[model samples]
Target chain A: MIAHKESGERIDPTGIKIGMWLFLYSEIILFGGLFVLYAAYFHRYSESFAAGGEELDRLIGAANTVVLLISSFTVAASITALRLHQRRRCICLLLFSLLCGVIFLVNKYFEWGAKFARDLYPGSETLVGGEPGLNIFFGLYYIITGLHGIHVLIGMVLLTVSLVWVVSGRATAERYSMLDNSGLYWHLVDLIWIFVFPLFYLVL
Target chain B: MSNQSLEQQQQEHLLGYRQLAVVLCLLLLLTVVTVAVSYVDLGFFNVPVALAIACGKVSLVLLFFMHLKYEGAIINISFLSTVLFLVIMIGFTFWDVAFR
Candidate 1:
């Protein structure tokens, strides 16, 4: 939101932010509906879910969690740097955050590759041959993580656009709603992963 | 007006680098704690404990990272209402499953 004193133009920051957050609310509900599905299935197939979670590599999951957390940190910090007119620092932090997102996707690629190698995909014969609940567990796994991966990709694209905007002077300190909103989207991604990690990888 | 001083005047919630770093440390610490806690088998309590920590992390991210802490009442209420509805939906479904 910018207040152009000379032209008497004003943008309400709260209105701008709340508009973005309204969209984020919908995103949360979309994922929340999925979580409810996971809950019901988990309620019925507790053992199968536990077993499926055990098959996952917690180390990789933890590492991704850290990557996302750090990425979020950088994104949030970049906004601060922008506000403070530390343009170089802001750009550097955004580059680092983008790298973190790339690392996350790379890690996910290897993780899913391992799963496919084990024939544990959605309609794999192994799950079809094994306990029915195991199929449900793995099915939910693919759906949730796959959807989240797409969100990560979209977030990276948004981040890239925001980076360019910053570089080109479109998102200055006074007028940075684009960067701020993009950061909000990125944080929502991290927020979802916070729940996903424990639910899918740390099932006890 | 200079952008920097004007921004400082208008945006009270412009988080500093130090504050952002501290929030990151807290989030990382929470992540480690949740993972470490998952190692101990706390039958029946494990999910709850893990979820509790996840909630903590979410709170920090929402408040510090997402700027929800300094936002307006409309946003705060809207978020709370959304979460309430989500809880109701999930709760009702589980309640049905439990009785079945």
Candidate 2:
């Protein structure tokens, strides 16, 4: 506890984690609100939801799932690197995780691009004239996955900042809560995708 | 008696790279299994089955990757309550939809 003192007192890692968990709770509830909509629509329109889901490329979805899962691994391992006093390994691993994030967003870009090309967007001419259930299904799909994609981008920034700190020695073994917290945030992104993958791509 | 060193606190629960690699492999395998199972048409059991596997993966990430397993009860209690309330909220919403 020789470092990271505030007002002559050592800052508590547990307290910072608690604050992060509280934010995560709010995040859970935020997504829960969307899940509730999904539940209602899923109950009333299983057929259309299935149809909309069928339009999704499970191979791509599965690929992104693998990508995020690997990113989660690299991010976690980066923390392990930090703990072992392997600063260069930590930086390399975080860079690898950021690469995965870019890969994810690129995949998402193409996926959404294909959809937009087909006018599969909300209130678009093609989708608007289709079954109301399909419309609702894609609506929820875009919103949920769109929001999760944003989180992925946010996570990349967090990891990048942490990477800078680690490189500059601001985030060291003695005081590396930023790296730990960034890892936690990254895992939460992975956690949400664990649900998102199946609900949209698998359960068709 | 109350002055446990920060180094000791952190080092006590640090995970090895081997453990992280194992968890990663298991998660990837479960992803494969879940995708494979989806093609089998498990009827009404499909969603629940997929979700159960996802839950297993989530637990591994939380316990190992997030280090919740080594954390104190305050953090555990807070995190668990979030999941608990999420379940309650989703359960009640489904209940209302079911009977209404």
Candidate 3:
């Protein structure tokens, strides 16, 4: 390690953070594009969007929100554990966070499965072939939530990798950027869900 | 790499367990409040009110969970600029739609 440092190979946490922030910016922009579309369609079909929102299971949405919130907290606590050099605690917290992600995805699977059962897919007979407004509402719903589910999966993978590193003793307090970065990404996931939850589930 | 610099950095970045717990509680409380509020009919104010609550939740996550509050000016500027650009994109789109 000393040799690597002597050779100018060092971990710069600041640089890592800046890069992460830039990546997060691009992510926000990606989702922002979808928000623009949602705004346009909501303007065009206010009643349809409300109708579509009413069909969503608010209880499930609320449960998912709680799950993600707890996960975000655990991930943050994991980073705090890392800083304190409690590797075991950090790994445990990360595992808990990963479990929350799984629970979230499971809930999503059931939610989407139920929607599919009702023939409420994008081009399905019930939604797309029905009213134009319902078509757009459900279409946007699938695209946005599907994309967010993918992010949740990605965040789980990241936390899992960080957990493995912690177990292997690679992610020490001195070089914990991996863990910190994962926490940031997880927070981004939660942040997006905050908006998505309201736009789809609550703000009818 | 020195012990002193390592210690200094830790001092700067280390967050306490109690603080994190408090923030978590606050977030959970806000979640319940938002959901409860949604059950009412606030007319046009419903969307805006829900969104405002969501924004509050996001701010807490960004500041405490993501540690943006503890970070320096450069990172703050970088992240805020992204929000600015997002606002621009949404604002312009709304402008065009409203006009047309």
Candidate 3 lDDT tens digits, B1-100 = 5986765664357778889989989999999999999989999899889989999999999999998887878889888888999999999998898789
Write model 3 residue lDDT over A1-204, tens digit each, in one string.
Answer: 121355587666777878988899999999999999999889889899999999899999999999999999999998888878888899889989999999999999999999999999977988756889989988999999999999999998889888998999888877788888988999999999999999999847
Chain A TM-score for each of the predictions:
0.96, 0.96, 0.95
Of models 2 and 3, which has the larger DockQ?
2
Best by DockQ: 2
As for model 3, its CA RMSD to the true structure in angstroms is: 2.6
User: Judged by DockQ relative to the true structure, which candidate is superior, 1 or 2?
Assistant: 2
Candidate 1: clashing residue pairs, number: 0
lDDT of 1 by residue, B1-100 (tens): 5866856554557888789889999999999999999999999999999999999999999999998888767889999999998899889998998889
Using DockQ, rank the candidates from best to worst.
2, 1, 3
Per-model TM-score versus the true fold: 0.95, 0.95, 0.94
Residues B15-97, candidate 2, lDDT per residue (tens digit)?
A: 88899999999999999999999899989998899999999999998999988998878888888898899999999999999
Candidate 3 lDDT for residue A90: 90
Per-residue lDDT of A138 in model 2 = 94
Deviation of model 3 at A97, angstroms: 0.5
Give candidate 3's error at residue B62 in angstroms.
0.3
List where candidate 3 sits over 4 angstroms from the true fold: A1-8, B1-11
**lDDT ranking, best first:** 1, 2, 3
lDDT of 2 at A29: 91
